[model samples]
Target: MWGRRRKHRPKEYFIFGTIQEEDRVIRINPSLDQPFVPLWFLRYVLYHEMLHSVVPDETVSGGRRRVHTEEFNRRERDFPSYCRARRWEEENLARFLR
Candidate 1:
């Protein structure tokens, strides 16, 4: 599932994407729904959130929920253009805040 759009609030930290696991939903930040954002980058973020739905979460000793385990990270790199998309985010994230 998808398509929940909302405006970003001032002083609110940015979130590029998120997954609601129980609902099996993936949401892309409305800021990224622009022509300037590459399609590959959008796909990368959507894919990342979708992974949270399929990948099993780990419960640690303190009963902490760990979403991004080693295997999850490894699988994330399998996405084509992963590195390029991440680099693009690092370089241009500030621009999206607008």
Candidate 2:
């Protein structure tokens, strides 16, 4: 449940965080290291990644990998302060992109 700051990347890269299943680690974007970032938001992102560790992967009819399955979304909503975290992300996305 720890995240490390990564090198600054352009918004075009559109990368945030990634979970390495093999290593069980989360690599976070450098933009998230700003002071404006709220703890709840960080917790939300971490929780989302942690969920991936427990949720089983899904395969569609076309054999496509569904990382965020319906069940995953459902469980995500169960997180305390889910709406608040999502709203904060939507409102502060530009700052992260900067």
Candidate 3:
């Protein structure tokens, strides 16, 4: 779930993306003034959310968000070039429209 589309929208920045019980959807920030985010970076984030949707045992004990599990890391490892995607997101594009 990228986000639930309500009759009245909430703050747009908070709507970057979301994960529902069994599905994941990523809503790109259209109001973002950046020219474009590379495809691989988007795929990486989408994969991150997809992992949450696929694994049902993710549990949060308290305020901490413990969505990732050992199995989640293993699933993430299946992506051969995860490092490259992280590098692109961290080093190349960090700033965005406010």
Each candidate structure's TM-score, on Cα atoms with residue i matched to residue i, is 0.83, 0.84, 0.58
- lDDT assessment of candidate 3: 0.59
Query: Higher-lDDT candidate among 1 and 3?
Result: 1
Off by over 4 Å in 2: 1-13
Superposed model 1: Cα runs more than 4 Å off: 1-12
Q: Poorest 10 consecutive residues of model 3 by lDDT?
A: 8-17
TM-score of 2: 0.84
Model 2, position 90, has a per-residue lDDT of 78
All predictions: root-mean-square deviation over Cα? 2.2, 2.3, 4.8
Question: Which stretches of candidate 3 lie above 4 Å from their native place?
Answer: 1-16, 31-36, 60-65
> How many residue pairs collide in each prediction?
0, 0, 0
Angstrom error of the Cα, residue 64, model 2: value is 1.2
lDDT string for model 2 (1-98, tens) is 33555466666545567799998798766668778888788888888888999999999889999999999999999999999998988787776665
Please give the lDDT score at residue 91 for candidate 1. Answer: 93
lDDT of 3 by residue, 1-98 (tens): 23334555454333334565633455554432235666676677677777777775655667566656788888887876798876765564435312
